[model samples]
Target: MLTKDDVRGVSAMIPTPCKEGQGGWQYEDSVDLDETARMTEQLIAAGIGSIAANGTTGECAALTLEEKLAFTRTIIEVARGRVPVFAGITTLGTKETVRQMRKFRELGVEGGFVGLPLWQTPTITNSVKFYADLAEAVPEMALMVYANPLFFKSTFPVEFWEGVGKHCPTVVTCKYVGNLMDPKNMLIDLPASMDAAPHVQFLPIDFAAPMAYDLVGDRLKGMWSTSCAMGPEPVVALQRAIDAGDKARMGEIMHDLHGLPNAIPDFKEFSKYNVQVEKIRCNAAGYIKAGPCRAPYEDLPDDWRALTVASGKAWAELCARKYR
Candidate 1:
């Protein structure tokens, strides 16, 4: 069984590799279980605190229900109690989301990471009800609320967050990826407000973990890590530095980790290729067998593909130098 404390470190967002098939794209509808299992083993070997499956980086919206559950089951199976597998439940409505969560729970998963229902942007009351319904439906399972306003299109106020946390004890963590506050000249934002609901730990998305750590330090439980998905070593190393209170080492690791993506042209603007780039990095690092993303997403421009692969290789080289 996994506890809330188990998630207080670097949890890798494991990517779902596609299989070769007779489609317009090279890899479509083919959930490559062998490669996914292999990748899970590698992440475990690299010392990731936990594995998060079917996230944005994992192309959760692109997968079928069957593929999603299969991927989650494979991760849990391969993990073999070495580390807890936190399944990602991203669906259209509260009913479907609850179904997915219950299914993963039936599969023996201890917990899940669920984003706000994306079908429509509900009001704070409805959002609170949505999560409350989910928590009530599956009272035994724990959840981490995904707070990225870019996709969810709603900024939940502190009251709303605390409402959900206090109302549902099953909701243990909240990963905020929105523009909640100034990352530059800030000491604390979410964590201080989150004290109202002491059970729920607040974390920035993995990208902002360094800034959050630099400002709030150990006040954060841990980030929901996307960077750790691609480059686990440097990201985990950064967390270790923060834990040890070594400022100099933290700066070095942050540079090495952030520098990897910045090495590419207009990397910040390359949101379209974010999933592909992470998959490319995992392949470059020998974490998974190389494969294209499922259709619609597979049609990457040649230049973008070239740049992403080059960036992944360059990042791997940096990781080898510093983390190895």
Candidate 2:
């Protein structure tokens, strides 16, 4: 099994490329494997530390199991061991999740990016047991806990981390998306979570990377970014700036990033349709061909669509000016 050290640097969460039809809503033959292959090569060439697919950005809930398998296979093959790959295996139940993780492990992925089972709110003990069961079943596969309070029921307090640390050794990292909007909550919660789970490295989202790096220093191994779908150059540069302790450069890059969401008409409302907004920006940026958002989550207002396009283009312009 891998350790926290094995999972480091700018970890990117990429959207799955959907085949074009019906104005970006396709139910059949949804995944565009050739485009996925090209996108994988682009990310690796851009110096991304790792690649993660089939998350919320990747439309995990909409993608069929066969589509996900083919998508993961394309990424693993194209990467060819250049960077570590973590594929999302989150499902509605533990048994199905285990079954999916086993498939990805056999495909030669380094680990699984998973969320807690979503049918009911999990208690602290069951939460610990959920991960413990996964580790016990697939001892060979490392785990990255997807700690998203927005989508899942659990808030994942420090006590939860304590239970995980005590019971689950195979959990090497967490995609720490909880309490991100409230820095006051983060200040108290993040470090406490770290203390409770010493072995698991916590990768905060790109917006919070600088604060997290300052808070924990070298112990903060890497960051998770959905913006990398626009282009990895800026995020990779941000990582480099953090590593060098160059606060000025970090600020410049973050300013550009922070502007992206502001370009949207209403960020809070836009956030509700995260999948569509992300795909629009990615296509607008023209970095990787992130075709379109898939079915059941593809609807977006015309006003939101226009602003998302501008936001993505703004990011592209920033990349060209600063990193390209």
On lDDT, the leading prediction is 2
In angstroms, give how far residue 111 of model 1 lies from its true place: 0.9
Per-residue alpha-carbon lDDT of model 2 for 96-144, expressed as tens digits?
9999999999999888999999789889999999999999999999899
lDDT of 1 by residue, 1-324 (tens): 344666777777677777755223333346888988888887788777777788776888777788788888888899997876778897888888888888899999888888888878778888888888888899888887777665686776677776776677787776666563434533245655566667776766655777777666677657667655455787777767767878798777677666665423553445566666666666665546646666556556677667677766776788677777
Off by over 4 Å in 2: 22-26, 180-184, 261-271
List the candidates' TM-scores in order: 0.88, 0.94
Where does the lowest 10-residue lDDT sum fall in candidate 2?
Answer: 20-29
RMSD of 1: 2.9
lDDT of candidates 1 onward, in order: 0.71, 0.85
- Judged by whole-model lDDT over C-alpha atoms, candidate 1 comes out at 0.71
